[model samples]
Target: MAYYPAEVKEAARGLYCKRYSIREISRTLGIPRRTVYHWVDAEAWGDMLSHEGVEDAAQRRLVLLITRDDKTKADLQEIDRLTSALERFQRLREREQAMRGEPCETASAKPEQQDQRGTREKRERKGGDSRSGKRRGRVIKNDVSHLTPEDFKAQLHQHYFAYQRELMQAKHYRNRQILKSRQIGATWYFAQEAFEDACTTGDDQIFLSATRAQAEVFRDYIIQIAQQKFDLELKGNPITLHTAHGPATLRFLSNNSKSAQGYHGHVYIDEFFWIRGFKELHKVATGMAAHKKWRRTLFSTPSAVTHPGYGLWNGDWYNARNKVKRQQFPGFKEMQSGILCPDNTWRKIITLEDAMAGGCDLFDLNDLKLEYGPEEFENLFMCGFVDDTNAVFLLPQLQACGADPAEWADYNPKLPRPFGNKPVWCGYDPSRSRDDASFVVIAPPEKPGGMFRVLERFKWVNKSYLWQVARIREITQRYNVQFMGIDTTGPGIGVYENVRIFYSRATSIHYSVQTKTELVLKGRELVESNRIQWDAADKEVGLAFMMIRQTTTPSGAMTYAANRSESTGHADAAFAILHGVSYEPLARPRGGCRVVIG
Candidate 1:
């Protein structure tokens, strides 16, 4: 037997817990292998290893190392490696449990107690309470007590652009109004903000978008942030988070004011300018956050000036409400710099240029300018409202065509056959040079005079004509496509020719002034009669229709045309839709008179 200091024994034990071999521990600690083995047996180290998982042992070592005052560089390196290993192990465990259809333990649960807790739950479910013959209610837990405001600032807010940070700093205001450029991440930032607020303050959070699909985007972002940043799996539709304050609910809703009524929480209304019946939706939103403690945030890209939300943004609505005491608001330039209006609303205008200056590197300015023509570029990325007065499709009429896709109980895009033997119409508008081609799947009227529902829309960029035709063929397999209309001008000729080989019902449309007029007129009738509807989230469809203005041809004849060029035809989606609906014929069929076109 050889004598060893207490420090040496402790060092050997620590190394052994870190999964070092006995021989390695001996060599590292300058001790004999026989003595290390003797200490390990005497201290019951094998029993400890049997009781603790690898993650538990690593966590124990990591905590010991972090608490030491005289840590060497090697100690810090070991800490970093152990932390990373623990994270990877946790993720792997979660994946394995998911594969086995087992529920993962909460982040706050100890590894040693997880098995015992799961077994207890199973036993409780199998045998009801011996006395009452009632099973215990299943606990729905979303433990977020470990999360601090500091954690959110470090993990999430650090990645925000300058404009996003500005929005955060203005959280004290009762109301926030933001007009931003497309794809500038306004919704993304607000999702994080609301989640953080809900987690920390236990305040209920509500998200309202133009459609349920858009509202779910916020919920998805929140779930992703919780999982990636904090190792939390937030479940349930209106996710209930168990925070230190209490349990708080996060609700996601659409612009249907009737369904949104009676909810009280912090409300975030997304894409308000594009929402139909904005005035009614605004009333519902205000009622939701009626309390002084709750906040309201409204954000969107600019839509047509005729939109009801435009009045709320430009101060006209406020002026009308306060006719006796009118207050002057800051000009557009001043608003671009962000300001608190006299009505106590914090307002800001963030254009693509402002977003770029604020550290958003997602767009090439010249490329976007060329992709969307001047009018579209101005409206979408420059925070300029559309003047739809001269357009064939006015904003009010086009807005009336917007509907919530969630209301369609018969359709599910996730299924293999979304429409399930029901007849569908598909329309394709081929791309011009450097411009995106548009395709649409529409559900025609169910009865003699019912509604036309746009089910799906796709935009293909820089794809070969063969690829486009292949995609169309795949759609035919999924849907019982009764009619397919393709424009046979420019690149469309290639697609139409190839599609005709497989789908005989494919119709070729040759574009002329008269042809376009007929297509535009039929579309107009559909819009005016409230017969055509699309997902409210598809604001681009409305913008596309707005692009078709009454124009004069080189011969001075009146014609309807978008800002068309090799680089700038933004009406592809609108034309694609018109192409599909044209199969119904320009004039409505009278009794016993069915007029169909191929």
Candidate 2:
């Protein structure tokens, strides 16, 4: 063991507290990285680092530099700069406290001015002044009183892409239905639009998604936009903004029909095609915005054609239900550039190509094409819905498995032990074309014939097998993992070997025709029985399951397979889930099946 002086150790600790990487600290202090790690662990440096704020860290560093026997000119300069910064931070804190109506030490020293200010405030309150009138009611946290319509338009014009402007231009229509490619910033744009509308018009904005977590994405985007564009921090769920007109509430809600009953506002439904029980949800959603003043916006990438929203998309539901004479609707091509239909709905289809043409440069077109299969590419990015007739797992049956994970009162992912001593099954499907691998954590039934809930699923791309195993090991520390199933046909074999060393319960699954058949059959049985559930927001799981199709091998035997070539990183989620569910056997051995000769 090499000895490090007290000064050197103190310097390393200071650097660590200053947010330097351990390797960086080690190199700077001329100590071995292992020694620094040991010191950090033994002295609990991480706890100190986390609890120490910026000002405290700077003060500590300044003290350390001041006590040093040998200091450079740069050190003296940094000391002077930090001292000035600390003074400025103190002044800013005092100003903030004064603004918040708290008596600051400096403000208290001047009693005459404080007394005059208090007298004026009291007189204004008693005399029914306009400023005091605005402050008399419930205090709104995010006040946008000074923001003008021109200010909003300026921000929008500067930040929005061309397609977003098109959506904005069509805001006059009462009903707008958009079919868009995945990840073209539709949710973000809608969040911005809703916030602006709520602020300017004082109209309530309601955002709906398949699950509460998904709905919060809208809330997050709104908060981010407000802070970035206007330097305002909005607070509260269903945030109420105090505007020039009045107080406007922004409600973020899941597709729970019961929870969405009474609100009246402009409604935005995100990923409507992927939501289960869409007809019921749509009924509640439409009822909320039944008034002529409220607008309805529905937007999503395409899902399976079997979804109920498909009828609404093709105008089949509209034509069949209405007693009025049936009207001919525009074809898909005619609607691509947007059209106002006879049903009084303005509809548009924006494919990936259209988004690119509209100047969204966020995606690499070639990479996306190479990453997804032809069918997936068309369905997910070209506004084409899945034709699931040949699929082994139909959308309707899989829809039964969609659930809101937020309703699980027992599980909190933020905790260190989210499932706390409850046994969870883990499954891994290794990468096939060095593209993508998937891992899942599934909570099995507490009682016989109960439900299996998928708690978490992760996808890794182009990572080594050791890294995958390390992640599995970390998951074990957080979960009570009783069973782990790993596909050992290819790179999975390496993962299985490493995992089994630490987790004795880890099971190796080698794929053959019979094994694949058994896995798919077991998974299908679970789905058909409605015994499995996953987060409703996760559309990928349903898509992965729908990718599997029945085909014949060279010997004319029926088999199931998904597109798993290099061009398409396919169905890993479905197989990972199957690996976990396969822990439950296809069948218990019957009494008659046992041979006496055995």
Candidate 3:
């Protein structure tokens, strides 16, 4: 018992080098279990406890249980809260239905279906009182290089919704990151932050980008709302009160992501997580227009674990949350010795209904401990570091067919086909030196409900791929495949002739043979875009040809070369030279049979 400083001996002991159970040491030494184990002697403790020093004693088990990390607990609580809210809402809805004397059982139930019911004829919002949300006055400042807190608040209020205020912050010019969440108002908050910066920070430009043109179009409301609601003049360079007559110059860009590159004052990318195809994102990253003084803020709702936006936000938020966790962690030492101490005290906004079962709020904040907790924070708030998942569309939007086997075939997914009895069009993407088999198939929708159904697909190992083309004759006859398109690399006339010979059944009677290249003219005419009806599947070089179709032709025959890539034949340069035919449907028949042949 020759005394040792309180933590001096504990600091030297490490996690498992202790004597007695963690609880035993704690009770014997009048110290917490974590500290007791920290001071334990490993040489002697090894004979009694495991490497982690967790023991087999019943009392130690009861007292030494590891509590959950905070973020995890927060997520669990959120799930519970949402689930509970949904349940309560459903019950309330049913009660309202009963009051109205309607069937309250199914989604398709009608009010007139039931008669006898409850007493009250009306229903209101949840909780005791129907009032929802707390209102707070906000200030927004503009037209200055810097801002007072009051001015900033004014600017923020102009754009901040109540639910969004939690994620909103003073715009930091040095950082470029995205904010992600589950049904959170991160995007709207960032928009407000950008609007404030655009108005107040002189010479600071602001660009708020959304996933679609429709979505970005709504950002104009910020200016309208600020001017009308707040009675603020967000015009003439909210920067130097100078009379530069322009439309409240906060430019709202739609997926105009490329424009976001090489010029950065302030770029707020909304719904960033849904952006697929890293090629464009990489352009923004490397060409990030932000000058030394510019900043970028990305915001989106979380949809996938591997989204590029998800990866980025996860990184910074992870480290930040962990800092707070380490600070309170009794045994662990702090790793980051830096200027920014982590402030991980984010309180969740819960429904009053959620707290009814438990006293006050029963959100358990300890379940969030994880190696990826900081990443979760990044995903939940700031998207700074991102993953590059090679996708061209949002995963959520890219829903594959269901597991139900019957719906596999004849199931008109999406909408009705766009073709409208238009002859089926086909495009062939032959493999170059690649290992996978060349894929030649029919695609494009006719009506809104039209979707791509693989009529015939094949994998060719060698020249035998052409052997499969013979089946195209049967498929053409089977479906109404009028015209077939092929990739002929570049100006290669010789290879085109060779593939045409292989596909031509005119000599064999399998079906008519037409070089797919020649069909290009017909595809230009009939196929809306050499591109496709946007069946929305990943095409090899198919998308290139489709862009060709988008181009309006000089002859009034729509040109098929509008938004094509440099490597037109890159996917199947040789296939373009191959033979494919365009079958144009003719007018009426003689005997009233009305031949609908292609």
Q: Give the C-alpha lDDT of model 3.
A: 0.37
With candidate 2 superimposed using the best TM-score fit, by how many Å does residue 76's alpha carbon deviate from the native? Answer: 67
Regions of candidate 3 where Cα sits further than 4 Å from its true position: 1-166, 176-179, 206-215, 232-249, 256-258, 315-598
lDDT of 3 by residue, 190-259 (tens): 5556555554433335543433332343365555645654454443212222111211245544344553
TM-score of 1: 0.76
Taking all chains together, the TM-score of candidate 3 against the true structure is 0.31
Q: Write the per-residue lDDT of candidate 2 for residues 488-532, one digit (tens) a residue.
A: 877778888899899988888877788889989989999999999
Candidate that beats the other on lDDT, 1 or 2, i.e. the better one: 1
TM-score for each of the candidates: 0.76, 0.75, 0.31
Give the C-alpha miss distance for residue 15 in model 2, angstroms: 38
Which candidate has the top score in lDDT? 1
**Best-fitting candidate, scored by TM-score:** 1
Higher-scoring candidate on TM-score, 1 or 2: 1
Cα lDDT of candidate 1 equals 0.83
